[model samples]
Target: MSLPPRRPRLPLRARWSAGLATAFALALATAAPAAGGKARAAEPPYEARLAPYYGQHLDWHPCGKPAPRPAAGRAAAARERGFSCAEVRVPLDYADPGGAEVRLSVARKPANGPGERLGSLLLNPGGPGGSAVDFLTGYAGEHYPEAVRARYDLVGVDPRGVGHSAPVHCLDGPAMDRWAATDLTPDDAAETAALRRSFHGFADACRSRTGELLGHVSTAEAARDLDLVRAVLGERRLDYVGASYGTYLGAAYAELFPRRVGRMVLDGAMDPSISSRRLNLDQTAGFETAFRAFLRDCARHEDCPLPAAHPAANRALAAFLHALDRAPLRTGDSTRKLTEAQATTGILAALYTEAAWPALRRALAAARSGDKDGTMLLSMSDAYYERGADGHYSPLMAANAAVNCLDAPAAFTGPAAVRAALPDFEKASPVFGRALAWTALTCADWPHRATGTPHRVTAPGAPPIVVVGTTRDPATPYRWARSLAAQLTSGHLLTYDGDGHTAYNRGSTCVDTALTTYLLTGTPPTPHTTCH
Candidate 1:
């Protein structure tokens, strides 16, 4: 499980990847802040910060400073029922706590037990940009182990620039439709120029649209906010579970607050030591592995759609892409146009979950028959960046880009770098190289420079952190999980001998049981534990 020593950053687009394309957009759009040697002053375990909230957002005045309390919606079920939601105001800039402020939306499912309660367990579903509050209210609270629930209050917070916070939406519906439809893999100089124009336009739109929020949505800032939430929750220490990009956040937190960590779990981890290009390339290989698994399953099915002849299947798929690239299907609808980019987007989406295989098969079958309905549905799955029909995005994509672009150094500066990387990227993913190569282009033209550098996260004094990895995970690959586990001094690697983005919630009872036991009882699975 030992990872190779990290290298310097690679020139962007020189490599391509599949599992590598994660936006932190729903998987981990935020990152935890860096830790320093200085110990933070201990305040009353929890008091609310309200004056800063009033001084900053001149738009509204607070009623009064209330002590941090929990809020619950109707659907929340408890041994007692009904937790609380609160706003914890933190400085917009950690370097200057007296400066501007931002509001963090925090939700809690309080402890319900005859036994003494522990503290809050903050949960994040890695999308650098995923809504912790939404994940809390909708998913983690209901599914968490009953024992864990009885002892610790489950908490979720919407990170800055994420859902219901000061969001960073750049495009409206029509504009988004066009953006998603833009050709990703250009064939020639002219087309490449057009692609570059689109990339610049997209960056410009984000800058012009999001303005201040874009630069402010760095992972370091979000990490500080998490500490604020931890303080307001009356917890002397922080306990958390972070998945996908959440691993990075957890690592960042552990790095920043080693002494405060209590039973942290970073599942489907990301390796912070590797260069972004290497990271993306490994992800590409992971996706290809997953897609081949899908292809194997598809080939065995009675209704297999891809041609038996690999050459024909590959050729036919290419032809279809070319046709759609030139003249997209009408779909006979006013809003949606089934373009080649949309189809590519769908294929990428299907690679995320094995449950998506049936949809991918059906979509490919329809596209082979020149119909677009099936493929369109897949496109919607891939359309996280777009505003939904209701005229709003999940704030996932915008925050995802902002966090990632700010966390790591840029991979490329322009198309020249991409062209140079073609050979390496093509070797990594022949089918997806060009498109993914363009992915690095977004950051090259980004308005912000990374505020942080890629560094190893080894909290020397932190409690044992359980790290889980699925053998063939596509997005945050299994190797990353292994690498992260090896990197941390007290990390224990838990292996899920299966597939998909994450292991615990994706049907492995063994993984679920192990994680629940750890969270509930403060026990770490023995090193190299395997769950089938």
Candidate 2:
């Protein structure tokens, strides 16, 4: 799920730099759920009670075009890309197999033949809320390596509660705008209380809009839904590419059905062994590492906006944040201003990939002078958070919070806990620690308490799972990939020594070639392999 912009717990970009030293040098790294939290009470084995769902057929057809950007884009772009679209219904609460059904929107591009066709390859971009259909149509098919695409039918399904599905809508535009504007790093009791109000306000809106769905959007439920999608797609074993938070979803799938696993790639993997607190703290350090890399790049740029000196430039960035806190500058729009929260988010958004660095530099230079950058930066960050124009939001954000909160208990106990943890978080990164620390309090007062605790996922009896990690990924840390690789029964680590959230297709021919080979041939890298 989306953390808070860069501070967000979940977030990606793909690149290939002909193996630049800066890119090749960093191949690297790497959160929780809650307990008594059996997502679903143990049920009958597969193919018994779920046969109706498995037997159901989706009548593939051309999906209708959606409204334009800021207005919600098309849910099925596969048709535009010479593919097909369909919908599959799964139980809302699996416990009641015959009860309310949740519709999952799906899209697929058939393989451009020559090679014997592999089964379907399902793709999921992170965001617990990110639209897998959107990802498939917009990026996956065209961008995924050709050999892999030729062998497997590329499939995308927006998980339950995400776009095109029965999305969970809460607050409207204006209320959401007000919620976003509330100071994340409140200074006193009154502001803190106001911040508390914003949290409750958002939660209440989501509950009201979602009804019982707010309780049903758990990760385990989504994983079960994924299996049904696999069955619907006619795949005996799931062939999947899941990134960031999707890695967690992939892990759950392997755990739930170890024998049904096929060739799976989990890039920017998550360590299911950590608690929510460790998840936030580790991500804090990650952003700091990414920001430092940005500074290094900034110093090298001809149009460099920061000071030439090392500590001096870092200090300047920190001071700019402090200035924004004291007096948020006016934006291009008179009604809106650049607050500390937005600025921090803007920075975090840029940290996602090296491609975003130029925009960050321009935004920073603008911030030093007027509100134009303020509007631009805020827009950039908000877009990353899935906040659209007109201050309206998507179920992506609402569902992000809902899924994460229900998957695990709150990271923060209360304001007192946050206050006590402030110094440690701040020391991790002076720029983002405070807002992220406060943002970690988001699910604290969550209406529901979660059931599952953090644990290792061995995926016993499964085929080799390829796990990729980028050393300085600002969102999901590299250490996570390493840890996850160790936990899995048969995880092969593919290290893209680069600066980005993920390794595959992020300009690394090495990473892409390795992934394509695995996808097409079911061949995985050697255990503990490193690629730059």
Candidate 3:
């Protein structure tokens, strides 16, 4: 029930096949030369007001040093791989273009081409808070398919109120540590009051530190920012690859600028038609499905720590977490103990991908041991929270809440509503239901009122857009993808009948080949295409 981070910093070993070569060849044959033209000119009086912003130039330079340690090295490596960074200025409020402004941090890896360049392909690893800049310079810039890289200038923009782009600040490290350890599921009225206090304190800190900017970080604004980015990059149309929550951002952009959309691949899609409450419940069920899959896999191995039977395994894991709530386990760090919340976070982290299941197994086994070493699980929890070794936390969670809270009405207005919803939530996922139901209380005390509402995005005139879904994605459910694909006027659903979050580069050659072809040649796979 921790808000799912879009792209976890987990090892994603790439697997390629001979089919990719064929796809690449076909792509090259159809690919067109990159145009140096500006975006289609804006229309009318509103366009006149926004002219200066759209007309400004980008001053690209070697990427800046990242705050995190090893990241400095990654930035250098990205520079070596033809990556550069820049800042694009946009209005803090699009409605008031002449008002305060924020600068978007952007990183670009120019096309590595012996073939025709298609244009800039924007990438966003969604969080509503994820740093697309960090995602590019750290992993995707170097790891995306060489075929796609050969013809496209890969660009990543940290949307306003995220990363280096005038980020939203709430609790500092120590405060965040305390907040993260707060009991998520209340056992009684006193505990419930404590949880309310935690949410209120977080909201208060955000209002005090983030100021007016906190109210403006909605996905709708972020989508407008994406348009500004596209224009500044001199693209006639936007070509993009967005995963998880990024799909919603892309959908918004398409709805707003349908004709400006080009080749877009939305992997791990979110259904824009659903309310925040529905999204929470659906995601809760998704994670439960993923957890069960992990348990089944774990049961096959001799080192598995839980009972082989599914129901027994679920009960056993639940008991372990509940026991931790009563008496936390010792992590190697003397300063920190693994509470039930942290353990749940750690378990959810592994459920993002099956690759992390063995690590989860090891961590659980260690915690069950006499020594009660909780180091591994604690480490994973820290990673999910984007906490550093130096005990500093990123603004990821703060910005995540800011954007989400502003995008929709509170899932539940107060504890009473949450209590009323518990029965339904618990039925959705016995292990995660209660905590996730409490998570709905997060936006109840937000300083800003909701500015957007749930609605289906048709993007009526947009070009063919591919929507990828994993059968067992833990964060965004496959059904959401189906719903989104059905909603989008031009959507093509490409299904990966496998486990894990997104499908494109996880391991499926079929998924990768289809996606690569679409990006390179503007051809969508057949509708409702299923790939194993």
After superposition on all C-alphas, the RMSD of every candidate to the true structure, in Å, is 7.8, 4.6, 7.0
Report the lDDT tens digits of candidate 2 across residue range 1-532.
1352111222232331211101111101111442224333235574477778988999998655563343245444445677678899898987788888998988888898789999899988776677777667766677777888888899988788877788877777777666666787888899999887788778788877788878888888888888999988888999999887778888888888777889999988878788888888888889889988988898889777788776787788878887787888777778788887778766776777787788778888888864435876776656655665566665666767777777776788788998999998889887678787788877876777775677777877889999988898877789989998888898888887778777776667788888888888889976666676
Candidate of highest TM-score: 3
Tell me the lDDT of model 1 at 140: 59
True lDDT of residue 526, candidate 2: 67
Q: Estimate each model's TM-score.
A: 0.84, 0.91, 0.93
lDDT of 3 by residue, 1-532 (tens): 2464475332343311111100100000000101001112235687689999999999999885564332454677777767899999999987799999988899998998879999999998877778788778766777788899889999999888988788999998999998888888889999999989999999999999999899888877888888889999999999999887778778878878889999999898888777767878887888889989998999899889888888898798899999989999898889999998888877877777777788779999999888888888888788777777788877878878888777777788989998999998889899888888887788888898877777777888899988988899878889989998988899999999999888877678999999999888888998668998
In TM-score terms, candidate 2 sits at 0.91
lDDT of 1 by residue, 1-532 (tens): 0011100011112211211222211221122222222223324332234334323321222212232112123233422346466667777766556677677776677788857888888988777666676566554566666777788888877788776567666665566667667787788899889877766676687789887678777766676677767765667878998887777778877776777888998887788776666666676677667767777788888777786655566566767777878877755456666777767666765566665577568777776674555445434434434334454444556666667777776666678977898787766666665566666566666677767766677877888899988787777778888888888888999999886667666567799889988887889887778998
Candidate 3 or 2, higher lDDT: 3
Candidate 1: global Cα-lDDT? 0.64
Which candidate order results from sorting by TM-score in descending order? 3, 2, 1
Q: Write the number of the candidate with greater TM-score, choosing between 2 and 3.
A: 3
Better of 1 and 3 by TM-score: 3
Ranking by lDDT: 3, 2, 1
Better of 1 and 2 by TM-score: 2
Clash totals for all candidate models: 23, 28, 0
